[model samples]
Target chain A: MHKVVTVDMEKDILAENRRLADENRALLEEHDIRAFDFLGAIGSGKTLIIEKLVDHLKSKGKESAAIAGDVSGDDDYQRLVAHGIPAANISTGKECHLDAHLVDHALEDLPLDKIDYLFIENVGNLVCPVDFPLGSHVRVVVISVTEGDDMVRKHPAIFAFSDVIVINKIDLAEAMQVDPRILERDARRINPGAKIVKMDARHGNGLDDLISALGL
Target chain B: MHEFSVMSQIIEGLLEESKKWSAVKVEEVFLDLGDFTMLGEEQLKFSYEILSKDTILQGSTLTINHVKGTIECDCGFKGEMSPSEDSPHRIVPILECPKCRGPARIISGRECTIKNLRLVVPDV
Candidate 1:
């Protein structure tokens, strides 16, 4: 079916997505599976962090599967599978992000009962995904220090809506002269309550801290 | 950039409106985005071309109308103006219009919307 969000009906359309997201959130809680969302800019090391997360889970002998929704290839899924984790690639075709309905559809094809952790890696884009809730129990926004500290002011929604702030690429904080102190201030200024985890996903630095923060 | 989300909504909205009409397909999407909405024509066109494929909104033409942004000034003046380039921000005449020399008020911009869809029914 073709769906249109006309100007006159935009409110109703958004309300519907919100309602579905809430229901999905409740369902996740019922299953005792904490869903954590990883959102970030185009090259903010989100993919690497997600990959590290799968490995971390396996190192501890936990069962975790991923639902990677991308606009392009299934490289992310393969990356997870190579780590001894099962993953589902939800190719959006043309959409920038994934919604509850799409995630629900993909989950039907997976062994929901066998998996203890359901990690949904959203598309790399930051703007559209903010509005769509994919039933995640926690929403973490990852930012690369190279993207500039002003990102907090440029797109406050990502920082504001996030439950945890993962400051990736801390290793380049010196080479890139990216100051965590300023980003930290800006991040906290927008979302004072969100736990900020600084890390270099590529170097494996701070991954353990992130895992501990997630209580995994 | 955000057109895909808006287009996705437009597609969903069109499907929903189609149910109301006996029309089997839509001919044109009459979208009246709010004047305050900052939608690029090229982006919408691109998203529609891709998203409308194999859907009810396929082959449908999109008609867009640009409306003026509204502004209200503290000096008891109200008017409308286009958002500044790149900034997409505006301030009520900090003092007054350079020409009219009066405080200006802004009321709109930053609106994203799809107004209506025109559908065609099969002629039996």
Candidate 2:
């Protein structure tokens, strides 16, 4: 009573996401906003590093806005707002990473013309975030020394796709018994072109190198 | 964690494709997963099994083909870099050019695609 119904797809599973990302990129470009996707693990200082970068940019008279993605809570979003930076939060609920569609929606709330740079802080996960690009001009992955020296080797794909890699919490290197140089070396091994910077973002150390790396 | 979302996307795509032919049921699905993608096949299948319920894709067989990561470098190095030197339990992949140990452009093995689908259509 039934017959064969074969459908040949040969289509990329992430084609929808990639298409949305391209649209987001074009919109950001039209607004003359340089966007960066800040990717890292939870407690890797991505938020603090962003705070420091915001302060640094403020000193240079450059306005920067942020879009924070997290599973729950508005703590990060509130923190950025306390610093007077225009920002919005996207709660993924069950998702681990932020995709282009969510970002595209968030862009509607952000005042694009009032900012020079747009920072998208992706949900703090290394593995999944690399697969989702949020229309950022540059993608930076942050890893602290507390995560250990093998962090880069453990997640090479993030490093490979990243335009910059920030090695945060270097001030605690002696206590953590991890060398920042070794981490930088391993990161360079995986991605020779990635600009790697060591820092204690909590105290604003090494933010200049990161800023220069972004050409901001 | 993200596997569920990826599975949902596949199911949605399959449903749309089947609708184009007025399929009564989906029989099988063939997927091409690149080695560099790091998406777990077991997890994807588990997600699919649960998400496809009540849909035409229910009870469909999911076949996955792992495409190996291939590299091409300015140093004329072109081949697949073998698995890392880490222990058996911890397999860290080293994706670099074997010849110059430099940054090589990855030419392939980052694709995640739905290749084909088998479906059932009622007689006209």
Candidate 3:
């Protein structure tokens, strides 16, 4: 005979993750460090924009550190290291997104006081990162022209949730046959007041505007 | 993609809960999934089936109840947004309030939880 049991979990599925994220936010607040989570698809130039931000911050004599999360590669971490600053990598073996627990562990060795800004580059995927918050003061989601115009519309959750939206690789819009305006309109519809930046990070275009928007 | 991890969490919870009654076999798992989370029910079930192998939960039936997305606006608008009619993806086509055209905050339909489980226990 089967004994049916009514297990009233009544628990939020993402509760643990959110609790860890809050802890990370508290730690960052203690050090007075501003953190941003860069989320985007794999080829959306997340690293390049970060490199530009690092360079811009360097010229201002501000120190910044990065935590790079990739599926199983040290490539992005090494690239940030090439900038000659403190950087670390969390290789999520099969996870599509980075959670607060991983970020909390990555923060154990960092010199938080010396860093002015902390950038957590989440594993490249638009969908899974929507619910995982890494305790960022600002959440920036990047979409490149190469990803096509429909990306923002198709993945509405990320665009709607991000604090800032970066449309990267604007220079390739013509070649990729993607109209940047379409993406901008879609983002606006999802989030009326979201700060949208059109960037060509390779040439450092629109970097200043982005910096001003972030107030960095 | 992260459904596997989520399914793993659900199974863990099931194991912990079943221990209280010393269940011998699991029969069915019922879930309440929200429409706003964009979680594919089929994918979640698939993940559950694959991860439950060799465990007590193996071969158990999975039942899901789709919860509708509800929202409230600062403008005093409160209602549920209908899931897209044509999109089999079940995405909420619009996120704004139809009454005021303002951004409506999602108030419900973001949970995925195990409502109950059917278990078989040995008669004393």
Best by lDDT: 2
Question: Order of candidates by TM-score, top first?
Answer: 2, 3, 1
Candidate 2 on A34-115: residue-level lDDT in tens? 9999999999998988888888789989999999999999999998887788999999998999999999999999999889
- Model 3 DockQ vs. reference: 0.47
Q: Which candidate is the best by DockQ?
A: 2
* Poorest 10 consecutive residues by lDDT, candidate 2 chain A: A185-194
Candidate maximizing TM-score: 2
For the record, the alpha-carbon RMSD of candidate 2 to the native fold, in angstroms, is: 1.8
Let me know the TM-score candidate 2 reaches against the reference structure.
Answer: 0.94
Model 1 CA deviation exceeding 4 Å by range: A1-11, B11-124
Clashing pairs in 2: none
TM-scores of chain A in all candidate models = 0.89, 0.96, 0.96
Candidate 3: pairs in clash: none
The model with the greater TM-score, 1 or 2, is 2
TM-score of each: 0.67, 0.94, 0.92
